[model samples]
Target chain A: MATTTMAAALGSGLRRAMEDDPRVVLLGEDIGRLGGVFRVTDGLQRDFGADRVMDTPLAEAGIMGVAVGLAYRGFRPVVEIQFDGFVYPALDQMVTQVGRLHYRTGGTVRMPVTIRIPYGGGIGAVEHHSESPEAYFAHTPGLRVVSCATPQDAHTMIRQAIACDDPVVFFEPKRRYWVKGSVEDEVLDDALPLDRARVVVEGTDVTLVAYGPLVVTARDAALAAADDGLSIEVIDLRSLSPLDLDTVETSVRKTGRLVVTHEAQRSGGLGAEIAASITERCFSLLHAAPVRVTGFDVPYPPAKLEEHFLPDLDRLLDAVDQVMGRQHSLTGWSA
Target chain B: MLRSDVSDGRALPTTEEPPDPELVQLLAPDGTRRADPVYDAWVEDVDAERLLSLYEDMVVARRFDVEAVALQRQGQLGLWPPLLGQEAAQIGSARALRPDDFVFTSYRENGVAYCRGAAPVDLVRVWRGNALAGWDPWAIGMATPQVMIGAQTLHATGYALGCAKDGVDSVAVAYFGDGATSKGDVHEAMVFASSFAAPVVFFCQNNQWAISEPVGLQSRHPLADRALGYGIPSVRVDGNDVLAVMAATRVALDRARRGEGPSFIEAVTYRMGPHTTSDDPTRYADPEVREQWAAQDPIVRVEQHLHTRGALSEDRAQEVKEHAEAFAMELRDATYGMTAPEPLTVFDHVLVQPSAELERQRSQYAAYLAMFEGTSGGDE
Candidate 1:
């Protein structure tokens, strides 16, 4: 076992994939010699040569479009989008081509491609750098969307994503890149299922569902709630698409209350979907309306205000308090 | 007018004898008999059975195209991009491809789609709003018909690049219109194709107009000549001449399979119909221009030449017409009988795994749908 940050885990995972499969290639801006701006791909080009670790032109659409072709040739391309907002230029290719290629081709072609984007706010980043756009990909069919919170998940999930026959959007929480954890060096023959949620903590008061950067916040909130004599169950949704709703349903059924959280805007966000699904499947079991503790319904604000804009431990606990019919005001509380 | 600089310096070498320079005429206008020795060798490979099959394919595709336009007129389809005059260009090039070759096409190549084995009924789903795409492109080794201008060119180039890496003998052919040459992706595709020496054939159907924009606006030189700038050889043929288009495509495909790299062919044709069912060409084009192109109709030339050669008898011609009509009727029945996709289908394929967000949206949408259903007594 080795202790590593999320970014380092990603680099190790990418290196393993490249070593395991000759067809596996890396393509994106600043992903080659520079090892990407975040250094998630550091040392990859030096180890694998330039052909395998390609630094593509500053065209997102071109990168995706070219990757589609590369996949057709039996190459597994892992593309890195510089930022969340910058991925829009490649949206057409992602939606129209990558997401639909398999079904459109009657399952004859497999787009074994992975798109990696560091998303969500916190750490005072500028516009376009910190934004949660997983919902957009999760909304597209024929694509798998996943996010990693822990370093272990980041390493294992990246490998799982590269091995997937379908295209996958791997959203990495930018703020969690520095967070460290123990990573298993030897490849596990059986890793966690790529599409299921993990119950990080067990509780019966309220089901706290979160992913990516929000998972850390949710776990912290749940710990704080524990001191307040509230057992807040925390679920880390590793996969955004093919949502492990069974896990959510089970947790929601037991707790009879659900509070979903993410760093994206509230309106029509991933939380909205989670709330609706839980209400439909676990309707009679719900103690109160499923609430969402998410980013405000506005563009990602400036660095200084981002902390307030993003869902925090207090906000998550407040949401829990509201759902459980407790005093909502945190005015006099000190953690 | 055809530009001189585009034509003057870029003519095919004269010494080896160009492939039937007489427009590669298999059938001539005015019902006359004519034969060129250059293409005679290739024509021998096209036996009586193959010739009849080619004719049948063209007829069926043309009928399908015509019926689609009618369907659009009757509001059965939202719109139809008619490939009326350009049937021969598509049919001829499509026939040149083997089953192993892959094709990436622009949205207008309905004829090529038919030849590639997509059912006529499948085409209706796209225009009828029942599906995002008509059929599975991979099943037929054809990518989905790309709607965005010139985007497929880059895809085709990438496919070709992959083919090179795999050392596969298969070549990828990209079908686009004259208008697509103006797109940055197309230019970039050309650059990539040339730089990598990717095995590809860029088949550009120069149909003279891009919606309201004339081909002249898209290029100052011939569309084929634009390829020469990238160190790729290019050919321009009378797109109305099916034989010429077929011959040119065959050569390009063969060269690509042999690892000779990419080639571009500009099939100079005319779009005798509107840009789409919703468009009105009368607003932008001259009546005289249409009249002139109509006189040079692709099918008419073929029929005239076949009749002169005694290869097409009056009875055989009648049989072809009857078959075409029967095919059209069968397609109409199949297309209209297709069921509109279920509303829930919208939520089904969005992702391989349902996300918390998607589940939420799906449930909310279902609730909204239920409210309407309840109010309308399940009508929705």
Candidate 2:
């Protein structure tokens, strides 16, 4: 075990997967010599050789389409789409071919392709670079969409996603690439399943559901709420598509109130799905209507306005306060 | 794009693109066998007996296509895309492949599927709208017919990359139409195949149309010329001639297995039917042009060649016809007997491991369906 950044942990996890399985290969643009745009694949090429760590041409559709073939050929190809915005060009292959190949073939084949996309915003980046597009994949039936927050999950889940038999859309929180945490070198046999949510903090007044980049924000909000005498439980929903709704439902039932947070637009985001599912499963246990804190329904703005656009501690707390039926409090810390 | 009334005397292609004077041909259109020194050597093993077998395969595939089209017309099938004129393009290339070599083809590859040993029943389930896919891709070493244009090319290339990485000698072949060459996916696939030196063959049956659009509209040069830009060697062949297609495919597959990276083959042919049953060819296709291509029929030329060689006796012709009729009837019976799939079976195959949500939804849907099990019709 070692303390490392999410990026390093991800690189280590990929290295481990490749070492353990000869069929596991990594393919993407600049992932070889440059070790990917975020350095999430640093030194992998040198260790595993170019055959396993392929540096493909700058073609998103080709990357995904080829990965489908590789997967069909019985290779576990983990493709990197570089960034959140760059994934659009490959969406056609991912949604049409990769997602439906198994079902279309009536289970004759399984596409064990892991598509890694560094997603979400708040790095003060330009247009297209900073956006949340997980809903588009979660909406795809054959795909399993997931994201990682801490170095531990990043290390464990990335390998877990690779080990999975279905096609997985792994969204890495680009901004949290440098967030340092302890990552166990070896995955425990009793570790959580890749699709279940993990309760990062324990409390009772209200439940804050978040994943990927926003989990840190929700944790901060939970910590801040403790000061106001309102105990808050935070749940990191690692998986988005086959949502760990049971975990969220259990938390909602205990807390009797819920606040969902994400970087995606609130209108049709994962928050909406969680809120609806929780309402269906925990309607009798709810003390108030579920609330959500998310990016507005607009194109992601320029980097300068990202702080305002992204859901932060204040925004999460504001939703928690609303869910608790409390009046607005001006006693929050200044930016 | 200007319209021309009474546009006779215009060239068939209607473009200034340079003609492929070197289009490979092992048999002339008039039943006479012509020899090309380079390609003839590749098909030297194809004797009179193999030629007869090829003829039977094409005949069977054509009969199956006719039955499928008739079924569509009779409202038995939702739709059918007939591989009417390009039989030799699919059969020749597919037959040239080794059993382990994989195939990723477009929707118009029923002939290829037949060559890969797919059963008649396995070929029509998806067309009958009773299944999502037609056949087991692994069992036949061929992927399901991809409806999305040019997407399979990338898959073929990636699979070839896998083969190369695994140190396997098998090649992956992508069968697409001339129109697919215009897609970005095809171009990107060729680029990757060349860059990685992947063992893949991009087999394009240039049937001269992408739906209603002319191949001229899709390319300024011959489709084979596009591969040169990607640093891949390519060949253009007379698609109507089965022997030439087989020879060219053998050459390409050999190159791929030899670690020579990827190669492209543009089989020049014409689609002798509407794009699908839903399309009306009279709306866009010129009857005069259709008549000209019909004279270059792939199957007739092979039959003519066999007759000239004294290999096609009256008894042999009768046997082939009887076999094709039997296969077509079997296909008809299988398709007619197919039942609607269980509605709840849709819950399967979405993932290797069923998720909690899918299980919950399956149970809920089962309950919803069960409510109607004993319900009677309402009275007025």
Candidate 3:
């Protein structure tokens, strides 16, 4: 077992996929010599040479559209969108072409293009850098969307996502790049399926669900709640699109309460869909409606006021308290 | 000042643009043959039989277009983009490509599809609402007809990049109209193609009108000049001349296959029909300009050239007419006889392996369908 940061794990994951298949080509801006803005692809260009690892012109649409073409020519293209907020320029290609190719072609042409984006804000960056835009792609029909919170999950999930025979939108938590964990070298845990939720901590009172950066926060919230005699179950939802709702439904069935949290805005967020689906699935079993701990429905605030904007242990704890029918915050106070 | 900038309105492209001296032409409009110094050797292999075959291609493709428009008008198909006047632009360039070369095309270019061996059924599959894909990409080396303007240029560039990496000499071609040149995707495609020196042929058929808007509204300079700014070798050809178009495309294809990087060709043609079955061209099209272009039709020029070469016997002309009639009949029959697809198939092929969530939804939908099956009355 080797201890690695999320960034290093991602680098190794890319390296492994390239080593396994010659068809895998990496394309992005500043990725060749600079190793990308976050260094997730550090030393790849040196090892793989310029053909497999390409420094593309700085155009998100061109990068994505080129990736689609590469896939058509039987090359497994791995594209880096650079950042989450900058992906809007490539949305038309993603939705109309990448997402529609397989269905439109009646399964003859498999996309197999892995698009990586360093998403979410907690590093106190400026506008467009700190936004959570997973919902836009998750809501799209043709994409498989996932996020990795830990180094181990980051390594295995990125590898599996690349190996999959469909287009995958792989989200990496930009703030959690330095987070470290022991990665079993080149080993993928068979028990932890790609489309299933992982139980980070098992408890009974309320289920606290989160993914990406918030998984670590929710785990801390559960530990803190444990000290207060509140048995909170923390589930790290790895896949966002075909959400491992079976795992969430099972947890909700057992705990009888739930809380969902994310950095993205509340309206039309992944949390809203989770809450609604659980309400329908475990309606009789639910003791209280699933509570949401999320950012307000506004643009990601300026860097200075981000702490107030982003959800942390305190907010998640409050959501747990609300779902558990306990008095914590926002309880029966008339303003 | 803004009012004075426009005398009548947006600059309507005049038919009398002082006959372009730079335009490459092997066959002139009046049955006259011009010998181009550089391109004459390119088409030295085109004998009497080869020239007649090109004439036949133009004839058959025009018949297919007429049939498709009639199908759309009769409510048998969803919509059809007619390529009435640009037959040479499509057939000439497409015939120059090898079978291994891939093509990414716009919604029109039924002639190109014809050259690529697309059956009448395959060509009209999407328009008849029978299927999303017109034909398999692997089989024909061409992608599904793209409706999004200028999007496929990037695909062609990227495909060329892949071909270069795979150590193959097959060229990747992109076919679009003049209006598509103004799109951001097209601009980005050029930047990427130029930066990587990808072997892509950007074939833009300057088919004067984009719906009701004229090409003058999109670009002031020649479309080929726009490509020249990107450092890609550019050429302007007389689109109505089959031999000229064939020569230009062969030059571009040869350059790309020789690993000399991308080339751009602007075939200046004219759109003779509405943009689609739904558009009304009479609103904006100039009758006088249309009449002037009528004398320069793509098929007429090819027929004139074929007659000069002693290739137009009465029996052969009758055979070509019969072939075109048969082509139109096949499309009409196949379109009318298309089988309806199953409703449950909508949930299929979204993923290589359907997720458990998709399976659940499919089952739920199946149960809903079961309810109607069990009842006496059903909603169709």
Candidate 4:
């Protein structure tokens, strides 16, 4: 095992995939010579030839549309949308073509394409850099959506995503890219399933569910809650689309309280779906209403307000308190 | 913009040929044949057997089109897009393709699908609402029928680019209606194809009507002339004449295979039926206009020419009828027997590895269905 950042793990994973499959290609703007802005594709073009690591035009739609055609011709394309807001231009192709190609062809064609977008806020970046748009793709039927929180997950999940036969939207939390963790060099003997959730920290008072960058914050909240004598269980929902509701329902049933958190907008976000599903599945076991701590239902705020807008440990702990029927006043509470 | 420059040049031909520049009609309405020596080299290798096959294709395609319309009227299909008068254009261009060539098409080209080896029953799935798509596109070297106008053009161009990168001689074809010319993707496709010198052919079946909009609204100049701006050669052929369309497509496909870059062909035809079964053309079209195109029916012209040459007998015509009826009955039976897909099947192919959220949704949906089954006497 070796300690590495999430970005390094992703770069290493892409290199491994290229080494494994000659047909695997990486296409995005400013990915080749400059490494990506986030450096997720650093040293990829140098390790592999230029043909396999293409520096495409600035057009996202063209990148996605051409990738579809390339996939049709038996090429496994891993495309990178530089930021969350930049992915909107490619939405039409993603929804209408990439998502529907297999069903529309009656299972004749398989689009083994992965669209990687660095999503969510907390980096104090400019506008359009941080937004949680996972709900849009999760709502789409034909596509699969997933995100990674740790370095190990970023490495393993990306390879698994690239190996998937269907089109997958792989969202990477930009803020978590620099976090360091030990990565196993050998193949995992029993790796986590691609579409399941994992319980990171076990507790009984309340189940705190989150994913991607917010997962770290949720873990921090769980640690702080433990100090307060409240055992807050933490569940990392790795796959957003085919949610691992069995794990969620099981956790909610045991805890009798739940708090769903994310960096995406509060209204119609993925957390809303999780809350509703848990409520429906474990309605009788609920001790209090499910509470959600998410980014406000507004545009990603300016750099100064990003921390306030993003769900931090305090905000998540407050959500836990609310769900656990605690009466303590929380930090950063607005008048 | 119309300028008369006759003073500085020689007199042009004043014969009774098409006044529209770039329009080439080799076969007259009266079944008389005319030839331009420049185009003779393209058709020199085509023999009588091939010509007879082309005619047979037109006849068979028309029969199937009629059957589809009848099926729609009888409520077997939700809707049908009839290619009644455009049989020559579809069959001619489709038959011209070699086994290795790839074809991308918009919906309404059932004749082309037939030419690509898809069974008639396979084509009924989309209309019956049993499947989102009809046939296996990879099995027939064709892409799924694109319903959105002109979107397949970009896909075809990109595929051709892939072929060029691999140095393959296989050519790709994009078939669309006249209205597709107005879409941004079509123009983008042309630009990309020309820049890359991709081996592709843009085959447009200008069947006069785009739903309610006429061809005149789609283009000011002939559709073929639009290719000149992109530095590609274009040809306009009489879509009603199967022989002419076949010859034109053959030359274009050959040029593409020889790495000569993309070519555009505008097959001028007319939609002899409504846009779809749901459309009522009686509200928009004039009776006299319909009569004018009916007189130039593609199938009748070939039938009459073959009969006069003593190549088609009454017995042979009867055999065609029997074959069409048999195919139609086979399709009806297959469609009637198609069952709704299982509920869990929805989660089967979403991804190679099902996601946690999808797994949860699938189980929840299954439980919902189970609850209903337990509460009710029947599973609906």
Number of the predicted model whose DockQ against the real structure is largest: 2
Per-residue accuracy of model 4 over B36-110 as CA lDDT, tens digit each: 565656766666556667777777787877888888888888899999989989998999898788888998988
Q: What's the residue-level lDDT of B127 in candidate 2?
A: 88
- The DockQ scores of all candidates, in the order shown, are 0.29, 0.86, 0.84, 0.37
> Which rank order by lDDT, best down to worst?
2, 3, 1, 4
Candidate of highest TM-score: 3
Worst 10 residues of 1 chain B by lDDT: B11-20
Candidate 3 lDDT for residue B251: 94
lDDT score of model 2?
0.89
Task: Please give, for residues B193-296, the per-residue lDDT of candidate 3 as tens digits.
Answer: 88888989999998887788777777766888888788999999988889999999999999998888998999988888889999998888888778777778
TM-score of each: 0.81, 0.96, 0.97, 0.88
C-alpha displacement of B66 in model 2, angstroms?
0.4
List, residue by residue over A73-167, the lDDT tens digit for candidate 3: 99999999898999999999999899889998888888999999999988988889988999999998879999999999899898888888889
Q: Using TM-score as the measure, name the better of candidate 1 and candidate 4.
A: 4
* Full ranking by TM-score: 3, 2, 4, 1
Question: How do the candidates rank by DockQ, highest first?
Answer: 2, 3, 4, 1
Q: Estimate how well candidate 4 is docked, as a DockQ score.
A: 0.37
Q: Is candidate 1 or candidate 4 better by DockQ?
A: 4
